[model samples]
Target: MSGTPDGQGLAPRTTPPSITQRHTALGIEGPGAPLADYRAAFQAARLAMAVVNRDGLVLDANPALGALLGTDPARLADRSAADLAGLREDPAQWAAYLAVLRGERPRMRCTRPLPPVAGAPRWAEISVERTADGRGVLLCLTDVTERADLQARLRHLEMHDPVTRLPNRSLFFERLAGALEQAGRARGGARIGLCYLDLDGFKAVNDTLGHRVGDRLLGAVAGRLTECAAPGGHLVARLGGDEFALLVEDSRGTDQLCELAERVLAALQRPFDLGGQRMSLSASIGLVERPAAETHATWLMQAADTTLYWAKADGRARWTLFDPERNAHRMTRQALSSTLRPALERGEFVLDYQPLVGLVDGVVHGVEALVRWQHPQFGRLSPNRFISLAEENGAIVPLGRWVLEAACRQGRRWQLAHPANPLVVSVNVAVRQVWDSDLVADVAAILARTGLPPRLLQLELTESAVMGSAGRPLEALQQLSDMGVAIAIDDFGTGYSNLAYLSRLPVSTLKLDGSFVRGFRAGEQPNPADQTIVEALVELAHRLGLTVTAECVESAEQADRLARIGCDTGQGWFYSRPVSADRVSALVGGYAPAPAVGSG
Candidate 1:
C-alpha cells in the first residue's frame, strides 16, 4: 500500500486483500481462509469486477474486468469506473453512479452501450454497490449484448404481421396511443386520421379458393395499400384477417383522409393474377379524421368501423367519411334497442290515446293507443324513434304485448265507467309481432284478463301486413276476427292497394293513410284527384261493408269534405293531438255531434 498526498491509500497489489482482512483493517471480524477463497474467486470469476473509491476512481480491478475492457489489469487502476462502463455518456446513469460512489445510495444498476471490441460484448450492464467496509464501492459489468439482441428480435417478430410483413394490431395500437398522447400535448390543430378497410367478398375467395390463395391475395392487397400510403408516409397495419388500417399522424384534414380512401379504393379495383388464378376485387373503406386532442383510441376506432359499415351498406366498393349526425343517430338507436327489453320490464313504457271521432256524429268513437317510451336517459321517445329498432331486434313482440294489455286495461276501465258509450281501443301492431308471436293468443289473453269485450278492442295493421295474408298471418287474423276483434287496415292505399283482395279477407275498416288526407287541400283550388280517389274509396268500402276512416283531418274544411265523401270515422289533429289517458277520458265525457256540412 502507498500513501496519497490526501492521506488516502493508493495501492497496486499482486493479490487483492481478502474481505476478512479489509474488514479487520476496518475493525470488523471474519474468518480469514474463506475470505481468502472469496478474494481468489473474485480474481478468477467470469464476471467483471472492480473496487472504486468514493471519487469513482478505480482502486483495483480483477482480471475479468481487465479482459472485458480489453486492457491490462494494472492499466484499469486510477481510471474512472463510470468511463470504463460508458455510463458517463448518460447524465441520469452518470448521476446514479456518482450517488453510489459518494455513499448516498445503496446501489445503482443500468445497461450502457460500449465501444465495439473484436471479441467482446458491445453492451454492458453496470451495477454499483457500496462495499461492506464503507471505504469503497464494488462495480460489476455484465455483458448483456446477447440478451439485448434476443429481446429486439422477439419484439420485431411480435410487432409485425407474419403474412403482410406490416405492423400488426398490437404495434399499431401502441403507436396510436403514443401519437394520441403527443397530439394531446401538441399546439395548434394537430389531427389524426384512420382508414379502416375490409376486402369485399374476401370470404368468398377463401371459400372458393384455398386459404393459401386467400393469404396470397391478402399479401397483394397489403402491398397495394402500402404503396398508396407511401406518398403520405402513413403507417399501414394489418388488423387481422382481411382488415387493414392506415394511420395518418398530423393529418391535414378530412380531405386528406378522404383522398387516401379514394386512392385505396381505386387501387383495389384492379385485377390480380395469383398463381394463374385471375380475380377482381373491391374494398370498402371507413375513414375518420378529427383533432387528436378531442378523441381517443376507442372512439376513433368505433367511428372508423361505423363509417366502414356505412360504405358497405351504401352498396360497397366505396369509401364513407364519418358523419357525426349519422353516428349520433346510430348510437342513439343502439342505446334504445339495447335498453328496450329492460325498459319494458322496468315499466318505462306508457300509452297515450288519440280520440278517433266519428265524421258524422263527431262522437268520440274510439281512441288509438300509441306507445311512448319514458326513457330515463333519453327522456320521452315517440314511437317513430324506437319502434322500428324494436321491430328489428325482436323487442317489438314483448313491447307490443305490453301495449295491447295496457290499452285493453284502460279501455275496460272506460267501458265500465261509461257503459252506455263504451269506446273501442285501437292498437297499432308491428308486422314482426304478427309473425314472431302468437298474436291471436296474446290478444285473447289480454282481453280476457282486462274484461274488455273483443268488440271494444281493434287491432290496426299496415296494408302490406294485411293484404298478402297467408299461412300463419291469415290464420291469426281470421281467428281474431272470429273472436269478435275488429281488424282495421292502417295506412290504407299506401302499400299494396289490392282493394279486391280486401273483400276476401276478414277486414272491417280501411284507415286511409295521412298522405291521401294531406293531398286534400281546403281552398277553392281543391285537389280533385284526391277528392275523387277518397270518394271512390269510400263508396267501394261502404259497398263492401267496410267503414272508411280518413286520417290526419287537421281542419273542419277537410273534415267536411271527408264526411261529404261518405267517410265513416276520422282521426286527426282536428279532433285532438294524442293525449294522456286522463285527457282522452275528458274528451270522451264531453262528446258532441259534428256540425252539419253545407253543400259548397
Candidate 2:
C-alpha cells in the first residue's frame, strides 16, 4: 500500500499511451509485444502504454491512450510525440530516447507533458523498457499529478488533527525532540520553553453549547494558537482533551517565552464568535525553561506539569515557572501523600488519641482520633502536613477509611478493657470522601467488621463539608445518627454557620474553634468579653441541644474559664498530649481535675 515503484501511481487517473511515447524520447527501454496485444492490454490495464520507434515516433496507440491525450488513437498514430512533447518545458525526452536505442543506458522513467484536453497540460510518469527480442520499445505511463496531491493530504493528516487541524501530540513531540536535540548541540545549549495550557471551564462549554459548537470553538482556538508562534521557531500541539502544549525552539532567552505567553493570554482574553453566541474562557499555563544539556523529555514535561498545577492553584489565566526550591517542597509533599495508602497496609501509619474529657465529672470521656504517618523518607508527618493534598488528590477516600477502621478497632478494644469509661472514637471526614463516596456504608462496614458498638464511634465534619451537601448527605447523616453513632462539627467558627443550619444539621456535638481558646491568654487583662463570647457560643449550642467541647485548653486557668462558661467538655495539652493507647489508659485512670486552663 505504501512503497510503490517509480512511474506507478495508485490514484485513480487516466493517461494517454500517446503521452507515454512522448517520454520514450528519454532513453527508456520498453517491453516487446505485438501492437495489437499491447494496444488491447493498455486499454484494459490501469497503466497507459503506447508503442514507439527508437526515434520517439508514435507507431501505434490504444483507445485509452487517446482519451488521456484528449484525442483518438487513429489520430495519434504516425505522429512524432517528441516534437509535440517539446512544446512543454524541459523537452529533452528524445535525448534519453536515443540513449536507450543505442544501448548506452538502461530503461528509466521521465516526466513529460500531455497537453490538457481541458484546463492545463498534465504531468505523467513515463517508463520505457527494452524489448527482450530487441524490436520497438513499449512505453508505460501513469498520471502522478493526482498522486502528489494525495501524498500532501496524507502528511497533513499525520501531523495535524483532523478535527481542529492543529498539530497533534505526535507532531508536537517530534518538534520538541528536534528542538531539544538542537539546543544540546549549541555553544551554550539554550533552554526550551514549554507552555502547558488547559481550558479553565471548557466542560461548561460542552454542556451549554453542545459538542458541535464546542468543536467549532476548538477549531477557532487552534487558528488563534497558530498565530502566537514565533516566526519560524515554534510549534503548538494539542495534547488531546482540553490540554495544549507549546514548544518554543531557539528560545535563548526568557523574554521570548514571556512575550509569546502574554500574546496567548491576550488572544484568549477576547470573546470567541461561535455562530450567534459569544463565549469566553481562560487557560492556566505552566512553564519550565530548561537547558538542553543532559536534559530528558520526561523532566521538561514534568516541570511544566508542576508549574501548570501552580497556575490552577493560584487561579487560572496566569502562568507560573518552575522553581527548584519550591518544587522540592512540593515533591516532598507528593512523595508523602503517594505513600499514605501503602503505608497503611505496611503498618507504618498509626493513630494517636487525645481524650475529650468531661468538665463536670472531671473524668475521661471520649478520644479524638489523630492519624500519623511514619514515612521512611519524611520521618513523621502530622495530618496537617499532607491532609489537604490527600483530599485534593482523592487519596482521602482510602485514608479516611483506614482511620475509621483503625479507630473502630481500637475503640472496641478500649471499651472492653475499661468498661466504665467506654471511650468514644471520632474520625474526621473530608468533603471529597463525603460527596463522592458512601460514607454511611463505609462507616457501617467498618463498625460491623471491627465489632465496635455504634454508640462508641463519632464522625467529625467541617462546616463547609456539610454546607453544600444537602439532600442525600443529610439523609445519610440522619441515618447514621439514628443508629446511635454520634456526629460532631470539628473546627467550629472557622467556617460560616447559621443558627438555622446548626439546628437543622444532624449533629450532637460542637467543638469550639481553637482560635478563641488560643486567643484567651494574649489579652491585656482578664477579658470578661472573652468569657461572655464563650458563654454565648455555649448557650447557643445548648439551645440547639448540642454538647459543646472547648478545644486547646492549655492551662488550668483556661480550663476554669471554659468550665465556668458551661463548656461541657475540653481537650488540649493541659491534660495529656495525643499518645499511644497504653499511655492513654494510664493517664485516663490517673487523671486528676486540674484547677483551670488557658491557651492563646
TM-score of every prediction relative to native: 0.85, 0.64
Q: What is the C-alpha lDDT of each candidate?
A: 0.87, 0.76
Write the residue-wise lDDT of candidate 2 on 459-515 in tens digits. Answer: 999876765558878888888898888989888878776556887877999998888
Task: Kindly list the per-residue Cα lDDT of model 1 for residues 49-92, writing each as its tens digit.
Answer: 98776666676788998887778977877666766887767889
The list of candidate 1 runs beyond 4 A from truth reads: 1-51, 58-80, 88-95, 116-122, 184-189, 524-532, 589-600
Clashing pairs counted in every model: 0, 24
lDDT of 1 at 480: 94
Model 2 misplaced stretches (Cα beyond 4 Å): 1-157, 161-168, 198-227, 230-233, 237-245, 271-282, 323-341, 358-362, 385-402, 412-422, 429-457, 465-484, 501-506, 522-531, 543-545, 597-600
Worst 10 residues of 1 by lDDT: 1-10
